[model samples]
Target: MSLHKDHVVRWNGISLGLGGGVWGGSVCVRLLGWTQLNDLEIVLLLALFVITPLALPFVFFQNKGPLFSKWTALVVFLQPLAAFLGGASFFLPAGPLAATFAAGWGGFTGLLALLGLVQLCQMRRRHRLSLTELCLAGALLYLPAGGAWMVLACWGLQPLGFGVHTDLLTAVHFHVIPLAALVITGLTGQALHNRPATRRGVCWAAYRIAAIGVLIDPLLVAAGMTGAQITSLPDLDTVPADLLALSLILLTLLGLRFVVPTTVSRVAQVLLTLSYLTVFFTMLVAGTYVLGVTTGAWTITIAQMIAIHGLENALLFGCCGLIGWRLRTGQESQRSRRGEPCAY
Candidate 1:
C-alpha cells in the first residue's frame, strides 16, 4: 500500500496500542506486589502511551511539504515505539541498562522538539500567528522538558527538595498540563478554523487568548516553583497556581464556545463536547485544589486530586478530544473528495 497519511496514522495507532498494552501489563505486575502505582504515575503512563501518540500524527505531522519531510514523518511515526521502550524499561530491575532505555524516550522527544522549533522558525519568518501552529510548536518543545524531569525522577533526584517524587510530579505536570492541554487547544482551534473568522473574529481572538494562556502559564508556574524551592516561600506557589487556574478555566470555557460547530460528523461533535465538559470539570477541581493550596483549607487531598483530576484529564479530555479531531478531519477529507462543501 502507498504510504498515505491515513496509513501513517493507522500504523502509529497500532504501535501506540501495543505500547499501551505493555504499560497495562507493567502496571498489573506492580500492583500484584501488594502495592500500586499512584494515580499520577498511572496517568503519566497513559499520557505517554495513549494521548501523545494519538495527537502526534494528526496535529504535528499532518501535512507533507518541504518543511515536513519524509524522514521527519518516519521519526514521528516511530514515537509510540520509543514511548513503549521507555515505559517498559521502567518495569525492569533498576540498573544502568534501565536508565539507558528510559533515556531513549527523552532523546526521541528532543528530536521532536527540534522539529517543532524548525517549524516555529518558519512560521516566524512568514509572520504567521496561527493558533494551531503556535500551540503545536509550544507543546512539542515542552514535551522533552517533561522528559528531562522524568529522567531525574527515575534517577531519584529531587531538584525542589519537596520530596523524593516531586520531580516525577513535575514531569507529569508538564506532560499533561502544558503538552497535552496545548495539543488539545490546537486541535480545537483547527476544528473551528473554518468558522467565518477573519483576523479579528471572535473565534480567532479566542484561539489566540487560549494559545497565549496555555503557552505562558506553564513557564510562569515553573518559575514560581523554582522560586518557592529556593526561598521556602509557600506563597510563591500560590500565585502561579492561581494563574494556572485562570488559564485552564479560560481555555476550557473558550473551548466549549467552539466545541459545537455544524461543521463535522455527529460522532465528532459528541466526543468533542464530552471532552470539553470533562476538561471544564477537571479545571474546576484544579481551581478548588489551588484555592486550598493558597488558604491551607485542604478540601481536596493530593490523593483525591490525583484520582479525580488526573484521571479525568487523562482519559476524557486527552483521549476524547484527540480522537474527535481525528474523526472530524476524516469527515472533512471525505467531503472534500466528494466535491462537497467542508467546514474544515
Candidate 2:
C-alpha cells in the first residue's frame, strides 16, 4: 500500500499522456465539425478532459498519507467509470437518467476538489502553504462549487429563471476554469521549485492583484448572468489579466536565469520556457479581449476566446508544464539517490 515517488511520477506521466491524447482527439473532432461526432465519441471526448485533470493534484501530493494516497488511487481508477457513465448519459433517452449521470460526475469532481482542499488545509496547518499552494487550493475549491452549479443546470433546475445556459456553463466550468487552475498550479510549482531570484514582495503583490482579478471575474460573470450591471465586468477582468501577465513575465525571466541547460534536456527546457510564455500570452489575449468587449473595439467572439484561452492554453502550456514537472521530478530523484544536493 506504500505509494512510492516513482509510482507517483509514473501516474503523472500517464495522466499527462492521456490528457494530451484527449486534447488531440478534441482537435480532430473540432476540425471534422461537431455534428460529425457520434454520441459516444462526443461523450468520451468530454469525459477525457473532465476526468484526466482530476488526478493531477494526486501527482503532487502523493506522499501525504495513507488515506490520502488511497483516495488518490481510487479517484484515478474511477476516471474511466466516470467517463463512461457521463458520456453514456448524453445518449440516454431518459432525461432523468442523463441527469443522474451528470450528477454522478459532479459528485466525483466534488470529491476531487474536497481532497485537494484537505491537502491544502493540511499544508496550511504545517505552515508550509505558499502562494502557489494557496492559488491551487482556491482553484480546487472552485471545481466542486462550479460542478454543482453545472449539475443543477444539467438537471434543468433553473433557480429564479435566470435563463442560464446549463450546458454552456457546464462546459466552461469543466473545461476552462479547472484547466486554467491546473496550468496555473503547474506554473506555480515550477516557479517555487526553481526558487527564482525575483523580489518576493513584487511576486506577492502581482499574485495578489491577479488573484483578486481571478476571484472577481467569475462574480462578474455571475452578475451578468443575473442581468446585473455587466458594464464594468470587462474592465474589471482586465485588471487581473494585466497583473497576471506582468507576474508571469517576471517569473519567466527568473526561471530562464537559473535554468541549467547542461543538466536538463533540450525538450524539457523548451517546454518549461514555453509553459511560461503560453500563460503570458493567454493573459495578454484575455486582457485584450476584455478591453475589446468593454469598448466595442474588437470583434473577438466567445467561441474564439474559448479556443485560444481554453483549448490552446491547456493543450500547449498545460501539457508542457506537466511534462517539465515530470522531468524535474526525475532529476530531483536522481540527485536524491546520488546523495547530492537537490536544487528544489
Best by lDDT: 1
lDDT of 1 by residue, 77-154 (tens): 777767876775556554566667768888877887888888788888789867778888887788787788777766
Over 4 Å off, model 1 = 1-7, 26-36, 93-95, 197-199
Per-residue alpha-carbon lDDT of model 2 for 1-344, expressed as tens digits? 34564665466556646655654665576567753433323333443454355335533363466667767766665655565555444445435666687677677778777877777868877888655555555555656555555455446566655433534444454434444543454345444444544335665455445544553444444554444323433444455445445555554544455443423556777877787677767767877886787778877876676667655555555556555655765676688799987664
Look at candidate 2 and give me any clashing residue pairs: none
Mark the regions of model 2 whose C-alpha exceeds 4 Å error after superposition.
1-63, 89-95, 152-175, 182-190, 193-263, 341-344
lDDT (Cα atoms) of all candidates against the true structure: 0.73, 0.55
In candidate 2, what residue range of length 10 has the lowest lDDT sum?
A: 35-44
lDDT of 1 at 264: 68
